[model samples]
Target: MKSTYQTKDFWAGCVYVAIGLAAILIAQDYKMGTAARMGAGYFPRVLSGLLMLIGLASILRAFLQPGERVERIQLRPMLLIVGSTLIFAASVRYLGTVIAVPLMGLLAASASRMFRITVPALVGLALLTAFCTIVFQMGLGVPLPILGSLFGG
Candidate 1:
């Protein structure tokens, strides 16, 4: 019925604080130019500060307010998300964006129970993919690895 936040969340918050603080300090070692372009360190420093604030908030909320007991722990959805991400990362180099993109899409879609991948869905996916390839590759001339030509290139 009642529970504090997960111990993992507390530790994760602490870790974020440490990382943000470390990043801010480390960026000072880099060469940042004057105010016009913003020094190399400026953006990172700002981001780290933001992260630090979030981490502090996370820590405070965990301590003060707490969270409800997870009455239902749905492992399948979590597994699907994590597994698909791993598959996407591992497959990207071998398959390239053309194939990998669809696989990633399918896997992400598969993550939800109600979303069954149908023939129409597959067709739509392929068509949209072709549109993307044309827009980004042919029209815009941005470089993305197509499925073929890897044997030669």
Candidate 2:
């Protein structure tokens, strides 16, 4: 008796399909060489194809099985997570990864109803920032400053 449109799986599948299709369409303009010698669009096209397959499977499963209903959207958490990403992107150049990463993590974690500013959490954030800094800035030799331009680094 439940409508398929109200199922969580259905909605999730729809989102995946939309994103996959969009990626595939956008990648169409780029060259797609052989797998051994991949072109600019090769990875995107391949990944998008996989995503579409998964979405189709999900859609099929939604129709064949009873699934949980799509619940009301949680705007607070959604907004917090999205806002954190945007803030990180906007601030990284000026504030650098050392500060921006933890700031973004804290903002995103606050989206959880049970989030607390414990010492452990702070330590974890610090470790994460350090790891990202080493991996991205040092290991990979990314040009992003550790201290950033805002601090005259």
Candidate 3:
């Protein structure tokens, strides 16, 4: 008999199970401690177990309910998103948050079809830069420079 379930859910469930089992294995060496006095591994182990359960439920739900078929993944957006993250990580140390934050915003915006190099994108960049600066630098008092040594700061 043909299965009514989507293959995607089954595979996703398998992945979750694998990850949970791996976490359990890795945490085995660490001291679990009591429920009151949790050890370092306890949280990860518990979270992984939960993830596995959720994945299993998703798989089961797929069989019982109708769902939209899996769509093809878009590579351009994925690449741009990953590239933006890498750019931010690489530049933040040298260029500092003031420069890197806006740059990341621009790059991330470029990943979407809705955004373009226009007034709105520029305004978004400005807003994001201000928000990040206020939150991470002023409010949180992170040690990152407003302008790095590269900029003669």
**What are the lDDT figures for the candidates, one per model?**
0.75, 0.93, 0.81
Q: Looking at model 2, which ten-residue stretch has the lowest summed lDDT?
A: 1-10
38-109: candidate 2 lDDT, tens digit per residue: 999999999999999999888888999959998899999999999999999899989989899999999999
| C-alpha TM-score for every candidate | 0.54, 0.56, 0.62
Error of 1 at 97 (Å): 4.1
Which sections of candidate 3 miss by over 4 Å? 1-6, 31-68, 130-140
Candidate 2 residue 61 Cα shift, in angstroms, is: 18
- Tell me the deviation in Å of residue 28 in model 3: 3.6
Residue 66 lDDT (model 2): 54
Tens-digit lDDT track of model 1 for 18-47: 999999899988766766888778789889
Query: Looking at candidate 1, what is the lDDT of residue 91?
Result: 67
Model 1 whole-model lDDT (C-alpha atoms): 0.75
| Top lDDT model | 2
Candidate 3 local lDDT, 119-151, one digit each (tens): 876887888888888998899998887786689
Taking all chains together, the TM-score of candidate 3 against the true structure is 0.62
Better of 1 and 2 by TM-score: 2
* Ranking of candidates on TM-score, top first: 3, 2, 1
